[model samples]
Target: MEMVDWNLAVATATRLVRPGPEVSREEARDIVAELRRHAKASEEHVRAFTRMEAANPEDADTPVLVVDRPGWVRANVAGFRELLAPLLGKVEERRASIPGGAVLGAVGGKVTGVEVGMLLSFLASRVLGQYETFAPASRELPGATESGGRLLLVAPNIVHVERELDVDPHDFRMWVCLHEETHRTQFTAVPWLRDHIQMEIQSFLGETEIDPSTLLERLREAAQSLTGAKPEAEEGADAEDEPSGESRGSIVELVQTPAQREILGRLTAVMSLLEGHADYVMDGVGPQVVPSVAEIREKFQKRRATGAGRLDQALRKLLGLDAKLRQYRDGERFVRAVVEEVGMDGFNKVWTSPNTLPTKAEIAKPADWIARVHRKAD
Candidate 1:
């Protein structure tokens, strides 16, 4: 029997509850043990958090930091709590007794810990029927997103304004949360989306290849450029019409091939649509929910304009999520404007099925989208 370590536990639990198995039995036993240990760890973390919350040494207004900041996890919990409240009375009356929200209410003020334990328990209970261990309503960020079916989120340990996702950020940060939550909701609602996202990622990896020599050349060029002496070194040289022709070439050799780039672009476009739709939906709802939205949005834009390095690295390193971010900003405006003109009922019709989503071109131009919506109205 393999000693269950943390890594093995994550792998084992992940594979056990995952859509498919990607490990061996001996390895799996270790994973199972690790999962239990991790759950205990999570519980400990929660207890620590509780102590942190209780100590009250720090400012109450101090911002909170999360290791795993999965959009769906936060959103689902918030949404479920909201969902659970109103229905609680009726349910209790029907049962004639339900222990006053036993597990749930006891878990209050310690929601995060309870939720972590819930996920671990859920993961372990796969021997039973298919119950969502982590659903749209419950998602978490991982130290690594490579694990299959594992919903993961991560953000900086430091943030401006607030923690716990409540501190205001000109609205953009809130919108980000909303967008992330939207992703969670879609996964939870669609059921197929979670599988689809992972499958697409696997497909992308299956085809992706990184060139060694080209990568080295590109690195050298990038390093050289950092010196910032290109113009002075080539002062007497001919005017360089092409921009970074040499460096681009080097990077090109090292990076994904054209065919692979296309694959990447396609994935980026899909992610963009996902992101854009989330933004759009939030816009539709936020005006009614959070008022300082537009100002917050402007602030968020400024952060991006200033080059959010963390965001950039994340997007660049992972399946070109950078492109997705850009596309989303553009797409949000396109979709929101359309919704305003088209009406909610009209726009809602689009999500009737998967095929109805706006294409890449459509996202680029809202006017075209409006025209299509008009045609639909007709």
Candidate 2:
């Protein structure tokens, strides 16, 4: 099997593919063991990578975070390869230089090899007083709870579909890899991005207030419904259940203060711009490289629509903890218009730095940027 097969296999960790008859407990155990092997291998890969890098590493000299199962790394690398491989052609040196390049598990010896690469990249920037630290978070996995500072961004998609429905898997994967790296690059390029995001979130949370009484009741109800049991009823609930324990016990989320609303509006604009710009670049480059971008985008959206709905809600509630804006499609369209009117170079200028990037007004009305850009150019 290929890389995508491995991806699908790992994801089906607990789920048994029972065909003719019910799967026996032993069979399920074996399947779980197989999945664990991937994790183990990933761990080993990371160790080996660290050693290798220590010997002859990237310029940053920062610690490399190697893993064997970085789904994001794999997907992004495949995407980039799809686009650059055919057009500019493959050159290992140049590929390494791709701002936020990451290698997926199957083709690599380490987990999301490019993750380490990206760390190295940002580390270099940091040395030059670019920023403080890079925030590496986890991917949102269903049923999987988060306890750590950030969710391990390991569960992102690796099984790439063709860029076009008619193309082969290789290009499809490459295109996705490139797409992710594109976002990484944007973040790395804008040093204050990490702080900016955190600041916005903090500001939102600080001002936005929650009703402690109502929130607690809603959460209790949710827990009761999902488990058919309460926390006190279960023995060692942490091990028995997923890790989505309540850091602050409650639900419905507290209401945001007026001051919080101000920050939230700004934060939303920033995220939209980033996400939308990524989609624009990735989608634009799809036809030029991968044949499966359309397929991946279509299936992914469909899946998000059907089953991933809960995750969508859970994420908004947890992260936003307050405000929730559900018009991502509209946001993406607005960003796309800006790019279409000018080009990557022009759009990038807007992101030359936080000061240059679009403010809430510009994002709300991208056409407003037209005047700004013209004024600057003139």
Candidate 3:
């Protein structure tokens, strides 16, 4: 059981991600200042909405962390490393007992780390901001001490996307902040939420396989997909094309074990609820505050739907981001339906406890959830 050097993992990810367009000191300062300004406004708006939506009132005192793409990669790398360490350790322990497994185990962590770094780098380029509530280890670090359970806005990526979409940059930036702030309020107001989500993640990781064969197979398939010719149907396929990767490779589809399935089902339900609620809040926060909110949402969604190059599309499909897009849509629908039927306060029952969350089936059939949640009270 060779120990994985988490430091090496972060270093590898940092190197691969590198830094995006260089921001001058003045530019950096301005970016931070603008995000901070929006952060405050977003907090106020989101906090008010969250209270109305969930019947929970709360506030986050921690200042937002405005960073660049590279900075995001670094922070995520650290977070992921800490979160996955226990599972990696367990893998190492199992491998040590197997013949010839020790040698592979020694290098396995490094390889996994590299893979993680690569993935995070890709995501960092796309994610505008995140409310990171899962990294307790990150909180111990100097700069991250006060960052736990706080909002993190990637200033550069937000700017880059706004420019690419040719939308109102200020409006777009504030919109992004609004979304993140909604998440911040969700976790802050529901103190148990952070722990619950973290626990689900840990349980899922406990069931995950850190086997070399599994990773190797995925890498080989990725290579093949990258090098393979596109089918005629896919030649001009839009970016919103359905994912082409095999379902077996998808984490969402890999819940075969009974325990894993149970945990996954719960996790999925919680994720759908949270994501849907955030989407609803972000959009429902009113356009008077963000004049271009509608335009921003339309363009942003279109951007996701538009496929990039073959290699890029393949990478996205392999990463299961396609499933994530569905999560957003499905979750949004669930929240909207439940609210329409039961009203905001009734929908708030979901936040009361794990028992009240909608199941996967319930997410698809919002009426079932409404009936169950309401029936119990009756």
Q: TM-score of every model?
A: 0.46, 0.47, 0.85
Off by over 4 Å in 2: 1-157, 160-169, 208-254, 308-328, 376-378
Query: What root-mean-square deviation over C-alphas does model 1 reach?
Result: 20.3
Model 2 has an lDDT value of: 0.42
Candidate models: Cα lDDT each: 0.41, 0.42, 0.72
Candidate 2 vs 3: which has more lDDT:
3
Candidate 3's displacement at residue 224, Å, is 5.1
Instruction: Estimate, for each residue in 1-378, the C-alpha lDDT of model 1 and write its tens digit.
Output: 111122333333344432323446674455444333332233223223212121122212111122222222343343334333333434334333445444533343244344333344332321111112222222332211211122222222112222323446334334444544454344433434445545544454444442335535655654443343344555445325444222222222235566655555555555666666666766655664457777655655554444335533432323223343477687677657666777655655444344555556666776675566457543
Q: Arrange candidates by lDDT, highest first: which order?
A: 3, 2, 1
Per-residue CA lDDT of model 2 for 162-244, tens digit only, reads: 22134554544444444443444444445556567766655554443233355456556555533434456654455225342
Task: Please estimate how well model 1 matches the true structure, expressed as its whole-model Cα lDDT.
Answer: 0.41
After aligning candidate 1 to the native by TM-score, how far in Å is the CA of 187 from where it should be?
1.8
Candidate 3 residue-wise lDDT, 136-160, digit = tens:
5344322223335557898878878
How many clashing pairs in candidate 2? 40
